[model samples]
Target chain A: MPGKSADKKPSFSDTFSVVGGNFDDAGRVSSRIKGILKKMCLPFEVIRKAAICTFEAEMNIVCYAQRGDITLSVDEDRIVIEVVDQGEGIPDIDLAMQAGYSTSTAKIREMGFGAGMGLMNIDRYADDFDITSEVGKGTKLVMIVNITEGS
Target chain B: MELGFIVKNLKLMVRSGSENLTVDVNGGYVGDLLSDVIANSKQGDIWITRQIHQNIVAVATLKDLAGIILVDNNEPARETLEKAIREMVPVMVSELPCFETAGRIYQLIAAREK
Candidate 1:
């Protein structure tokens, strides 16, 4: 079956608050994105994966950046989420992206997250993952998922 | 035991606006994460948590929960409450912390069902 192609794209700008280092505030952002995807009738599995990825990325912001925001752009064929934060930059992007690698504080681990699976999970779920970090400057993550591809 | 007894024991408020926090809950599960709660909680079980976000409703719906009880006297944001009301899933507010609320609900469920 051929998919419908559209020349026009719908864009949305939404901001969610990430509390400073609070486990309670985790996953709030992803939930919003998930709701948006659901309203658009996207596949449940894809939404689920995106939710998980967004959560880990947002948590990274809270744990390291102290506060952050996630901005999303949805097009006909892809969903692009940009997680930007002014938190301390990843000292080693390679180490951070490695599965089971985490710089979480003890407090975060106690809350049942931060087991070092955040970034790797993001990579596994996102079709495209890019991270730009400076040791002291900050970090920006761009994740693009093509939902119609592998299905 | 009927659901009325459990509601009487906890003195819970029906925040879901479904006309009852009064459903018979068969078991209890407590977790802040939606994924864990979705994976662990069984149907007819009461979910106890302090997360008062809108997504909690969707998780509860997916898991087919009897009701959701927000512990620690936490109030969900207005928007979340509005959605829950629309979903017709009963929500309760309790002063007890998550742990205590879980125990109380469990004891109530077990006692009534037994």
Candidate 2:
């Protein structure tokens, strides 16, 4: 298995900040993270999955939050991405998880986003996913992608 | 089929990454929704859309798409074109509507397959 030998400690880690309502630079952080992963020479599948999850998380922060931070840490066996945002948190996680349910405004839709599929896309790509939010506090997401098969 | 051929056959205006048009196009995907494109677009598939945002360039890069074709004469945002040039992802424009552009490209690829 690549990146897996004897140690399981993280070999690379980085955190990126996203400012809410900053549509001009929404996906820049995700692009940088993708570049980092590509340089690390991680498997193409792993890099693609991690990039998709992080991009969705970053978009959520840009669309809804006041500000947020995305942290990416890669170890021998897995890649972990955590996004924490200060925003108008989702009131109903179950409802929000449903595809095609969105609270986005006209401007967001005009930008070709906010079709209510971001969270679901992240879930579909991540090996393990966790989400928690408070009504007015913020939303937090943790997504992990395993490197080794069935590990 | 290669992206350059599509550009020539469709009479597309190359806006950025002109040198990168030789990339092979395995298929095509038409969608304006960013998430839909990101989730469903396959590698080497030329993406057809009406959106001209800089984010479209990001999606194209992330998905390893063959390139992006903007329909209805929609020009990309200035920053979008710059980013496309920098990332070496070809961006083209077509005067036709999204449906017609998609249909023509689909026919081209389908014909090549046979």
Candidate 3:
């Protein structure tokens, strides 16, 4: 009898480093990850959720941090994404998570990002989400999305 | 209704991405708040907004929107037009006010469903 592992797709991983304040390439990393997910033949909805979360994370880095790293790891049934950044972290996590609360400067707002929904959007799109930060230090987010049941 | 049909009926100016005029139109949602649009809009929906920034292209692309209609004569910044074309999302404009254009779009799609 074949083992359960044999029935699962092989695992894959990718990492991208995003520069903060780089508005031009804010969504570049997410776009690349989306392309990879498309090749994996994941369902449309799943890919879309992943893209939104990744894009939001990337934009957060661009808006507030000095730089960040995004990692995509897929193992059979689930896809996990982790983003870690270095910058001025949120002072009040609860307030920041509110739908419309924003600390974005006028410059970022003019470009259509930093609406204060980055964390919420990412949380909503991911099946499991976690965030931790230290003021003037950095922020990190981990988002896990199920791929097996998606269609 | 098809995107081309909507464009013709509304007499909107196709500012860019003319080649994407054929994208199938499913519905329309009007909003300028970026995060709200991202959370509330549906796939293949035609987004009506006053935001003419390039980041609009990223939002629309992630949502797989059919096209974008900017109201109140809000012309997109040059980079916005470039990104819209690169993403294959037609960006159109209307001299009409935001509410009026949204109303017309609602009627167009509602009539099609009937």
Candidate 4:
């Protein structure tokens, strides 16, 4: 008979570094996380949604925060991600959540994002999202996606 | 040549899936707006645009396109370029604007199939 061995299975995890306001390195973190999720053969739709969510969070780091980190952990039941950034904290989280409220500069607008959909997209895609911030300190985002029972 | 060939001929760098450059382009789509591209771009088709942000990569990655071409000498921000290179997705830069680049790509892909 198997003892405690049956209870332990190999765990899969991934972490990525997102530099602060570094346009040159902006999406690297999200792309890495996206690749691993794909290789795992997770649901295509789910992965796509998560990619959008991740990108929004990643962009926030590049735009608002000086630097950030994205962490991906796949448990038996859910996938959890934490986006931590130390930058000019959001002065008005509620305003930023508004669909069209954007603080993107001309430079950022030139790139075709910053229409103020970042937070909305993240909230829309993730099962749960929570943001904590201090005006001059920084912002911390916690997002989670529940794997559909058998999925 | 096919779209894939044009991507190769242009010496467009592959930022992701470097081993799988053999793309089958059913058609081509060019736009600067991420929403439009996301809404209209078909899977396995080449996408041309001038937007150079990390979001562009996210859009393409999610859209699952054949590749992305930053037309009119447009280059993504350093961070974006680095991400593209790391992802191994194909990206080409050209000095032609939206229309000319699309036309050339169209002609190339069309000529190949015939």
Candidate 5:
């Protein structure tokens, strides 16, 4: 329940890279993100929501993309996460966002990811969410969660 | 409901984080899908799942769940157990399957709530 204070966190953007099929280390990025957010002494619900979004994004990269980077930053009133990944981009972004539809291979499913809830969970918790992708190219997500209520 | 009481009553294996045995269990949720738990589980709920991976701990911590009860006689990987301790999110296991574990936990929580 105790976390490092914000004074110890990186002031600006902090980026972490994800490699596809790295199930063993998939949660590391989000774990660090949660720690930094906690150190910043964000509200309990705010930290929890951000951590969920962060973990969902990391799992998406590990389950589908060949490689990706998650960049995190925070301002006075909000936190922003930018995720960019290179892999088999979603052919239908709309369908993909629907809960319970997943294109994950059997292999990925066996590891307990790829249930198709990642993107939706990310968007559900964020105050602002945008996703763009092209087939055979990559996907980019810019998600923002307001730190203070109704801000 | 304390995590220790459930572990003892169910005869589950204390795979990790014994120091956290006293965490209060407010209720219970049954799900294996990571997102389902992340999206639906309430804070302080005990999660019953077949998953025994490190991500299990990640979701539990993120949701602020009281602890995780792994069913189906599955054993968590060494790293999975290690992460439970590191995150201080207790993980326990029962030889029973997921549904049965949920049923029993439901009864326990129901009685406690009453």
Candidate 6:
């Protein structure tokens, strides 16, 4: 089981790798992350929110990056998911964060994604969200979801 | 409502995950956007959409949805069927359009609640 002691420090951490342009395996990491979080016995709301954010972040990597890694860490106080991808990074973070803005290709749209809501959705679910990208390099996202209710 | 009941009532053709038809469906959501469905759909809500890509299965799995009904007679792609089967996420087909499909399912769920 996941580690949980009297102190509220992180007790679990694992990183899952994701390959870019592999639509066939997209969301695999997120699903595994969800399973891990479930085993940790977090609240339903926290698991759902974390799963949603992780899935969106994973999708972004599969659709845009060459490769990526998602690190999931949990503690008594919060769950932290960090996604780092090697891909063509976003040129304009502000525009990309918009609800309907997207740079996805027609193929991505045909797959029912790239509506420009991935980042926004991640931001919505995460209690703390941060994103950074370098053009032609890569992007990194950090999302934290508090384990306590309303904390 | 049980997923099997909805399939029988709606005459939805189960394309994959036949063993999972026994699962319970708590509600219904109709949308083609993956993000919208992931963001708003509750667990056990049967998702109705026209998208047939494999990613649809991924979304359904992530949300713990009861199942997916592809409206407008859209057929699930080969890869989609494989993924759905592997994930045990039911994928069904409906000849009706999204509007009609969502309306009928909504009525059924409402009637059940009433």
The per-model lDDT (C-alpha) reads 0.71, 0.91, 0.86, 0.73, 0.85, 0.92
Question: Lowest summed-lDDT stretch of 10 residues in model 4 chain B?
Answer: B11-20
> Which of the numbered candidates is closest to the native, going by highest DockQ?
6
DockQ, in order, for the candidates?
0.10, 0.78, 0.53, 0.29, 0.63, 0.90
**Cα deviation of B101 in candidate 6 (Å)?**
1.0
TM-score of chain B of each: 0.88, 0.98, 0.96, 0.82, 0.94, 0.97
TM-score for predicted model 1 compared with the true structure = 0.58
Task: Name the better of 4 and 6 by lDDT.
Answer: 6
Evaluate residue B63 in candidate 4 and report its C-alpha lDDT on the 0 to 100 scale: 71
Best by lDDT: 6
- Model 1, B21-114: lDDT tens digits are 5566667788875545644567677788887766677666655577778888888768678877887877778888888888887777667666
Clashes of 4: 13
How far in Å is the alpha carbon of B22 misplaced in model 6? 2.1
Q: Give the 10-residue window scoring lowest on summed lDDT in candidate 3 chain B.
A: B31-40
- Candidate 4 C-alpha lDDT tens digits along A22-107: 77666667767878888888877666666767777887888777777788877655567888888888889999899889888887
Off by over 4 Å in 1: A1-10, B1-114
Worst ten-residue run, lDDT, model 4 chain A?
A: A1-10
**DockQ of model 2, rounded to 2 decimals:** 0.78
TM-score for each predicted model, relative to the true structure: 0.58, 0.94, 0.91, 0.71, 0.90, 0.94
Q: Which tens-of-lDDT digit does each residue in A32-64 have in candidate 5? A: 898888898888888878888888998999888
Q: What is the Cα-based lDDT of residue A59 in candidate 3?
A: 88
Complex DockQ, candidate 3: 0.53
Worst 10 residues of 1 chain A by lDDT: A1-10
lDDT of 6 by residue, A111-136 (tens): 78999999999999998999999999
User: Which digits, one per residue and each the tens of the lDDT, describe model 3 over residues A41-117?
Assistant: 99888887888889889889989999999999987677889999999998998888888899999988876677778
Off by over 4 Å in 4: A1-14, A149-151, B5-21, B27-30, B33-43, B52-63, B72-88, B93-114
Cα TM-score of candidate 4: 0.71
lDDT of 3 by residue, B1-114 (tens): 789898898899998889988888878888887777877889899999998888788878777789889998999888888888777789999888988998998899888889
Distance from true location, Cα of B52 in model 2, Å: 1.1
Off by over 4 Å in 2: A1-8, A149-151
